[model samples]
Every structure is written in C-alpha cells, then in structure tokens.
Target: MIDIPSMQRAGANAVKAIIDDVISEKLDVEKKFSSSKTAFRIADLGCSVGPNTFIAMQNIIDAVQQKYQSQGFASHMPEFQVFFNDHTSNDFNTLFASLPPERPYFATGVPGSFHGRLFPDFSLDFVHSSFALQWLSKVPEELLSKNSAAWNKGRVHYASAPDEVAQAYTVQFAKDITTFLEGRAKELVVGGLMVLNMPGIPNGNPHSSSVTGLSFDILGHCLVDMAKEGLISEVQVDSFNVPIYVASPKEMT
Candidate 1:
C-alpha cells in the first residue's frame, strides 16, 4: 500500500507554507495580489492518484478563501480553479473518482506535465509542483546529440548514474523547466507565484547506483520491484535526473 497521504502532506506543506507566507508576507506584490477576489490561483502539477492531492488542494482553497473573507468580502467569495496535472500514466479515474463532491471548488485533470503549460494564455495565478519535477521525462531521443550513450530502457532510477547519463537527464529537465516557466509566465497576470519542491542533494551527488540521494528513490523502487515481480510489465527508468528548479522571486513577480 502506498502512503499517498503522507507523501501528499509533505509536498502540500511546502505549498501551504509558500501560500501562507506569501499571503502574510510579501508575495510578488501584495497590492497586486490582493486586487483580485481569487486571492490565490494555484495548480497542483504532477498530482498523482491519492487522497493527499485533494487534501492539499482543499487546504490551499481554504486558506485562500479565509484570506479573501478576512478582507471583508465574506458574502461574495471569489472564484478559483486548481487543475490537477500528471503524466498520461497517472490514474485519472482514481484521482477524479476520489475527488470530494462536497467541496465548492472547481477541479480538473490536465494530462501532460507541470513542466508543460496546461492552461490557455494568462490563465493562472499560482502554481505548485511538489515531489514530481525530480523525475525527468523518460528520455529525449536526441540524448546522443553530442555523442552521448543512448538511454537504456531498463535502467531504473536516476540516482548514481554515469556522468553523461545524468547530464542527459539533467538537460531534459532543464528543457522542461524552460517550458514550464515560459508557459506560466505568459499565463500569470504579473503577480502570480510558482512553488516547486522536490528531493535534491545539495552538491554531493556522485555517479553510483547506491546513491540513496533522493527520497523519491523509494517510490520509484517500489514500482521497479513490482515490474521485477511481473506485477507491472516492464520498467523504463531514467539513468540520470537532476532535481533542480529554475524559478526565483524576481522571475515569479
């Protein structure tokens, strides 16, 4: 059984703090942020199947609502929409089926990556991607553009991978970040915020299979073992991944 709840909470806590601190402190621009009734517009990118995503979404909604109500508009609450996103492999039925109908919030699933834009132009205010950006896309076909080795299909996990392999994965991730930031920038109306949190080892990452570098390795391995046991057909893990984000307070503002 996967502890999706705990995993969701850990990630959600990051967003919660970011939202709260932003609302309380100086997020982008307070006057600009407060000008709208929405208070905060957010998206949970890479939110997989589980109750945790919903809880986190609800937490953000509640916080934003409270922020709005305290502003003296308790009767006329603002509208908000948070799109839950993930790869095509994610269990959308499970995620949507589990969505609590009692909540008065708009939610939907965007089939793609948080690293990719899911909404139309200028359609968001805040974006939260937790614990998911670390996993690079399977691999780019042109990984060998500069004569690098091809990424094998069975090489599961990115921790402790060869330098070149890791570089390939890292480069792909950078492309994703470029896509994500560029897309979000177009959608955000000047004062939007994006909070991206994932597992990363500061500067001690070395090329080795036993790198125990990221906590996500545990989740990925469970999937690997399932594949090994024939529970899941095959495994195609990236040999390298660099868990780094390219967002700053200046860029978000």
Candidate 2:
C-alpha cells in the first residue's frame, strides 16, 4: 500500500532537477557565506512527519557541499542546522524520532504556520519547502458565509464551483502567499537562496478541468449522496472545505 511518505517522496523527487539547477547557478556560496564556523541554518517549512523530509534535506546538503568543494572550500564546510517546521498540531515527536541515526545535521522542530514569521531576521541561510505551498492559511471566509455569492454549498472545494468561489480562493491564495514571502524575506540572510516546489496548472487551464479538480468533484458528489441517504447532515457537507488551492502559472506569478 502506498503511504503518505511514499507520496511525499514521489512528489519531491519530481523536482530534483530544478533543485539541483537552482543550487548550482543561483546559490552564492563564495561571497555570502562566512568562512568562520557559524552553522548554516536551513528550514523546511510545512514539513510533515516523515522520512521524506530527511531525504530532501540531505539532498540539499549534498548539493551545497558539492558547490563548496567545487569552489575549493571543502575543508571549510560549515555545520548544518536544520529546522523542521509545521503546524502546532503536527506530530513533532514522531518526526524527531524518525530522523536518520547517522545524519550530518543537527535537527530541531519548529511549530507554526508558514504564512507568518517563524524565525528571527537574517537567521536562515537556505529555505526549502516541497508540495506544501498550495495549502492556504485558512479556508476562504467567503465560502463559509451564507450571504456570499461564493458560499461553497454542497461542495468541499472550489473545483467546478462558480467563478465567484474560485475568485475567493484566488484572493485568499494571494494574501497568504504574500504574507509567506514577506516573512521569508525577513528571515533569510543577504544572498540567501530558497527553493519552493508547488503543484500548479498550466496557464489558460481552469482548475476544475484538471484531474485534481475532477477528483474533488467526485468527492463532493459522494458527500452529497451520503447526505441524501441520511448518513450525514447537509449542513456538514455545506460547511466543509479542503483548504487546498491549486494555482495556475499566472496566479503564481
């Protein structure tokens, strides 16, 4: 059976090429990095409980080490300190327990939402988040209001919903991502590099027309069917939402 870790690894692996390329070209190790023994801090925002996080972090460390070696600074390799961040409700104990026994970096857990500030200014040298940014800080308030045109009645997601519903999601995504970027800007040191891997649709494609949307539509139909059979309340279905937004390329820009 495919588990959450497997799924996370699959998604993260898909972006390995992008991560390597970005690190090789964009990361400035020579000028920005201190030759002293200060630890190189890294944060994995929205990192869920699992082995996949360790693998992804290790890949980053390996790439950075290669860069340092290529630039003739292998002997001056800085110590790595990794922060695993997630919502307060996440199972941090399990995440910590699952760390690789012989790992190189010192690991720490940070509990908080990524949309807000979670680190001191100019503290982090590298930031990484994979398959996580598509999540909104919260469900769009417009969807829960009965008087709003975007009220997500009989649906748990904006996929296949009216344009107003989709628009509400778009607005929330913009706000949440802006806050996230602002917080990260304050946290990263000068010339610091960040890698974000998110799921997105191509330009000109409606979210409802994508495979993920169709799946959500089916889920909504199932929930409505269950409501009709008196297995669940209509109110429950009406108030439910997945709080996930699949952005288009344009929306991301």
Alpha-carbon lDDT, every model: 0.62, 0.88
Candidate 2 has an lDDT of 0.88
lDDT winner among the candidates?
Answer: 2
Residue lDDT tens for model 1, 1-253: 3354575577677667776766545343335445655444567888888576777777666766676666765566666777888888899988888888886677778898656667877677777777676555445544323355645334443454455555655567677767767888887766666667654443443534222334345655666677788776653343333343222233233
Candidate 2 lDDT over residue span 127-233, tens digit each:
99988898999999999999999999999999999999999998999999999999999999888889887777889888888666887899999999999999999
Q: Which stretches of candidate 1 lie over 4 Å from their true place?
A: 1-5, 26-41, 140-158, 204-253
Sliding window of 10 residues with minimal summed lDDT for model 1: 244-253
Cα RMSD to native, each candidate? 5.8, 1.7
Clashes of each: 2, 0
* Residue 81, candidate 2: alpha-carbon lDDT: 97
